[model samples]
Target: MSLKELLKKKETAIVAQWFDRVVNTYQLDTSRFLKSQKDAFANPVGNTLLQGLKAVFDETTDRMDNETVISFLDPIIRIRALQDFSASKAVGFVFFLKEIIREQTAKETQGNAALQAEMLLFESKIDELALTAFDIYMQCREKVYEIKANEVRNRTFTAFHRAGLVADWEEEPRH
Candidate 1:
């Protein structure tokens, strides 16, 4: 079978493996909660990760578009970006798909030159996904920083204004 066909056949197993890998990145308490919860509200992060991987796996390997890939990944990335994870830990789940794919296709494509080449091509798609993920992760981090700065500004504004430390106040027009 062609590499794509093999991947399509094993999509469910691949997604399950990938999801497990992503959840394992969390602390044990979080991982336990994620594993046991199924509702999207109860486990939004886990649900998003699972749904995103499934969408990715459903794409034709060669035809996966950047926008669709990013859309699928953004939710999971945003959640991780707001958390305490380093950049690698936040986006490294993309690479986990490679291991899942490799394990799933190993026996079928072993020593087969043409199939092996196709598998490499598929792996390249994963690499592209990882790059896209990094971009999304950075953007999410920037938003998080912006939010934190705004919160600090809001809390400090009243104190600074009352003490006349912050001038240039643009008072609202009276109704």
Candidate 2:
């Protein structure tokens, strides 16, 4: 069978495995709760991950649009960023996909040139996704920093201004 056909056939299993791996990166309680609840509202992390994987797989196998892949990955990466995950941990899910694809297609692509080429193509696409994910991850971290900086500034603004630590715009009247 063709690589795309194989991926299509095993899509559900791949997604489930991917989701399991991603959830495993979280804390024990968070992982258990996320895995136990299937409702999108109650378990948004798991839900977003599954949806992102499905969309990424579908798009990659069909056309491999970089922007669309990044868009699909945004929710997953943003949540991870908010969860206090490091940059590598936040974006490493894309690399996990390579392992999943390799496991599923290794046997079929071993001796077939066409299948081997398709596998290479697919792996390259995963690399593209990884790069895109890194960009998304950085953007998410930047936003987190921006929010934190704003909070600090807001909390200190009045104190600093009252002490004349900050420059005033208006001229002071002569005593």
Candidate 3:
């Protein structure tokens, strides 16, 4: 069977392993909570992550275009961007899929040139996905910073107005 066929056959196991790896990036208590809590509302981060991972895995295996793959990646990256993670940490989950796939399919690809080539292509796709994820993370971080700057500007303006140091300009009447 081809690499794609093998991946599809092992999708459940691969995704489960991938999810575990991603969740383990968090604190021990938080990882346990994320793994155990199945409610979407109560565990929104976990829910988003699982859903995102499944979608991204499906897209990657199917050789979907970058834009399509990025749609699945956005939510996961956005959530990570808001957290206390550096840029690499925010986008590092994409690489976890590569390791999970390799571990899951190593035996089959071993000594099989065709399967090994396919695996290389699949890994390249994963690299592209990681690059896209990093871009998304940066965009999310930029938006967060913009919102914070706006808040600070608004607060400063309010304080100045309250202190009579700044005033709203009155429109002059036109003749």
Q: Rate the local accuracy (lDDT) of all candidates.
A: 0.84, 0.86, 0.91
Residue lDDT tens for model 1, 56-114 = 76763647877787788888898888787889988988898888788888888888999
Arrange candidates, best lDDT first: 3, 2, 1
Per-prediction TM-score to the true structure, in the order listed: 0.84, 0.84, 0.87
Tens-digit per-residue lDDT, 1-175, candidate 3: 9999999999999999999999999999999999999999999999999999999999999967788788889989989998878888889989988888889998999999999999999999998898899889889989999999999999998889899887456744557
Candidate 1: segments with Cα more than 4 A from true spot: 60-62, 152-175
Clashes of 1: 0
> Residue 84, candidate 3: how far off, in angstroms?
2.5
Clashes of each: 0, 0, 0
lDDT of 2 at 173: 55
Assess candidate 3 and give its TM-score to the true structure: 0.87
Question: Best candidate, TM-score-wise?
Answer: 3
